[model samples]
Target: SLDGASDNETKSESGVPEVPVPADDTPEVLNKALSGLSSRWKNWWVRGILTPAMISFFFIIIYLGPMVLMMIVLCIQIKCFHEIITIGYSVYHSYHLPWFRTLSWYFLLCVNYFFYGETVTDYFFTLVQREEPLRILSKYHRFISFALYLTGFCMFVLSLVKKHYRLQFYMFGWTHVTLLIVVTQSHLIIHNLFEGMIWFIVPISCVICNDIMAYMFGFFFGRTPLIKLSPKKTWEGFIGGFFATIVFGILLSYVMSGYRFFVCPVEFNNDSNSFTVDCKPSELFQLQDYGLPPVLQSITVKLYPFQIHSIALSAFASIMGPFGGFFASGFKRAFKIKDFANTIPGHGGIMDRFDCQYLMATFVNVYIASFIRGPNPSKVIQQLLALRPDQQLHIFNSLKAHLTEKGLLPLLEEAA
Candidate 1:
């Protein structure tokens, strides 16, 4: 019965003629027309030369400082949110749900308020406590966030039209998922940048390098397809990209490790009315001589510690990072769309460019937390100094009592 149904057959209820679904099971044709030399050259001009030039211009913004970088990330987050929300709107446009767009944007504002509030409270707790208003807000950040979210929920319910109820709920779900994917990850990216620009720059650059090299390698020598999710990707490209990214990551890390600007965590210095990245660099960014294995000892006597970390970073960028892109490809394919948008001539939208970066950001954040991050005593002390005298004394007394109970204070008194 299924085999007898014609492609143009209509559904009984809606009487809408079904659009034929493209067969996804077929082996992709690698020798398509775009594989020709002229087309490839044109693609290279857009994707290779022009794209990198634009990226370099943004890198100048990055070089300016973390403040500029944060602004740029905020702008990018807005653009990406716009692009994704637009897709949802287009998909559900037929329903014409009342206030869906407005509610979606409202939800975005609420989520950003929550996420950025947490970031500020966590990182700039001292600055927040210095001002009475900020101190109050910081203290009640979560409660305020919940209240704002509940307001939006109430608004959405009130705005719901009788006929478009299902569509409105669908859009609501869509908006929330998009917010989680876009907002949450962008916040983590900012966290990575603040940790040290190296965490942000290195991981992102590795992905870019991998993308470029993979494209180049695939263009020339591609034969076997890599995965069904991304038809254009090839085994040759993946292999070439992996090796190239490893070398790039190591060299970049070595060069960046020598510079305090790249190595230092960003901090807002209120005394100077500016942000500062001036501190004794962490060991990861400092040179530590590592002994070579017996086989490699004759070829090279020693290596910097970061070179080993670079291998791991590059491996993730080259291997795991592209899976983000693969996931995006599958997402687009499911929607029967070509790209998220043609915002860039060769690339898609901001979301398209950042899909891999978000995944990389998540990985870098986890890596830092697990391996690099520790209890920051200096930061804790700074926060203590910022508190009111009574509050500071309270904390000090509490700490002393805890220490005394643990028997550490008695040992310290004996030593004194």
Candidate 2:
């Protein structure tokens, strides 16, 4: 009778059907399956092919058109750092992370001034001169550096004193890392420290390459679980990546041969065709014989270019890069985030993009600051001054004319 009435009213109710809510375990299981599927698809489809394409585009700009590439690199650093600070601070929500970020914004501004040698008063002047009272050595210089640091420290300490220990930790940890990074990179780029830059660059590059390669190889070949924290990873892939990165470094040293490299040529040394990091700018900038080979022979007489020590350095980089990535992965897991934010379809967030860069910066900063930069500190100022057009052509030409009028070409050339 229930099934035999008019079409609309004839349907059975199936004894009061129930709307089911899955058990707690069901969601967890589904999440795992979904994550696995997503990881597979993203890595296979986007990261694998697209990463190379992006890198190719990047290389094209870097080689054929560099100004934009440099700008992009600098911008990426700025943006990534901002995100790192943001995510790192998220854990300190109760401790006023937003305020800390605001302070950082101001700190960056002050740092720009300190490095660029610009001041608020400079805007009022039509032309800045050597005598501009606002130069680094001026009376207000120490005052400014002190004030900036003190302000930051006070804010940091106050956050802790207010029971914002979490934020305090972030601020404290980052401050140290910041000090380390700035000290290292500034010593190389600004000071032109060759050895430090080399050790740092090699390690940082190796580590970054290791991270990328691990992600790649693992996504394709990984089967065994490497760590519970990052379930998608595998020991096989890790091993492959570690070696791959070392090889990548060696190859990079080989491919980018015409530029600064760790492996000097045979003419540079007679140690039987190995690799070495004991490189000199004179060698790198000039041809093989007159430039680098002899400089290396004078340094590492016994070790080949690809000696044990050289491998050690590359190994450090290859390892550290993945270590950094693992650290980032742990942080992400704690937050239960898929990626830092989805800025890249596959790459996750800005912090995700720079997780390796952070470690690389640290690696480069350390080596350069410790041994490679050597001793000179004032070279940057001298170089920048000499590089100035007013000091280079105009001033030199005028001096040359006076010297020539005095009939002193020998003295002029010697003085120059």
Candidate 3:
């Protein structure tokens, strides 16, 4: 009887046909269904459980090898690039500019080619030199990148419609800005990873630790807002997250330092046909005696140098890293959107998760270049090996002469 009544209800009472409802699989229906869920349940399901579970899965992959981690970083870079470019497209939707999207993606390709080429040349010099095609490509990578970019520029110029010229230029600027923000920072992140998995792992972990602790503290006792850009961020949460991150960073560094796999830099070993992190750990990873300051002298505090550096890294993650998220918030406010996209169910887009991370990555790269990186003798030796016999001999003689001039020949000879 209910089925017969439903069939009758499908038609108007006057024997006119009724318009059928859209299917349940339609975007509108799906969105409505999602919107029906409570915010608390969605947030808890995604943020509390799914997010951590996903992070743990990623950590397992990272533990397996840096190459896997690098691939993950590349995927994130592409997603972030997509998110930002999509935002730009939406913002400038009124202007129908030709080749804007095409050119934006082309430029991304050019930039990634340049950056990844540099990384491969720098870190896998031996592997590159051994392959005839790779060796040629490595020699002229920048020139080729420049040529590819110029081709895109020419295409953009040729495709420019008369009335939408201004709009095209505006989009060009938008695309470049997105590239800088998304692609450039991701390059630095990979650089940090190559330096040592610890460099990559610790800073990222600190950021995650800070984010979680800040939210916990804020949810329980947030009274004063930290910034207008991010209203939910509170002073109490900031302070709590800071201390927690510092301790977490120190502990993480200590544990990672003990393992050569974590502390050693990722290098390609042609002989092994794979990348390896098997070298002796750096001074930063090794334990070192440090005297306590006057405030802590009474407590008999002695610690490794890395433990001290961990505090600095955590401070950046706790303080400056959140500004990146604040900037992202302001950007979303400008766009009048809730999140970058609905890619991650309740956690928002990949860009939302990575906004703070990109800034942290840039900071870590600069910190490494300024403080952590030194004249890597192994790399120099590899380069020397790749050179012609004449060049290698010249360099060898020059190095020997310099050592003699510096009165270090006896020391070197004795050691040899």
lDDT of 3 by residue, 319-341 (tens): 99888899999888766676777
Better of 1 and 2 by TM-score: 1
**RMSD to the native, candidate 2?**
15.5
TM-score between candidate 1 and the true structure:
0.85
Over the full model, what C-alpha lDDT does candidate 2 score relative to the true structure? 0.52
Provide the overall lDDT of each model, using Cα atoms, as 2-decimal numbers. Answer: 0.81, 0.52, 0.81
Given candidate 1, what's the lDDT at residue 328?
87
Name the candidate, 2 or 3, with the larger lDDT value. Answer: 3
| Cα lDDT for residue 298, candidate 1 | 60
Compute the lDDT of residue 36 as modeled in candidate 3: 62
Candidate 1 structure lDDT: 0.81
Off by over 4 Å in 1: 1-38, 297-302, 382-416
Pitting candidate 1 against candidate 2, the one with the higher lDDT is: 1
- At residue 50, what lDDT does model 3 achieve? 56
Tell me the tens digit of each residue's lDDT in model 2 across 1-416: 22232222212122321222213222344345456565457346555554676567655654432224324544664565566555556544433443577666655555544543433222212222244564434437657866887887677666554333443565667645653443333322322212323343455456657777887788778889988777887987788888887777766554443454323211112243221335454433332322237646654332224323335556766666666667878866665555655565456665676566555555554644564345544434444453667667776788788878898977767889
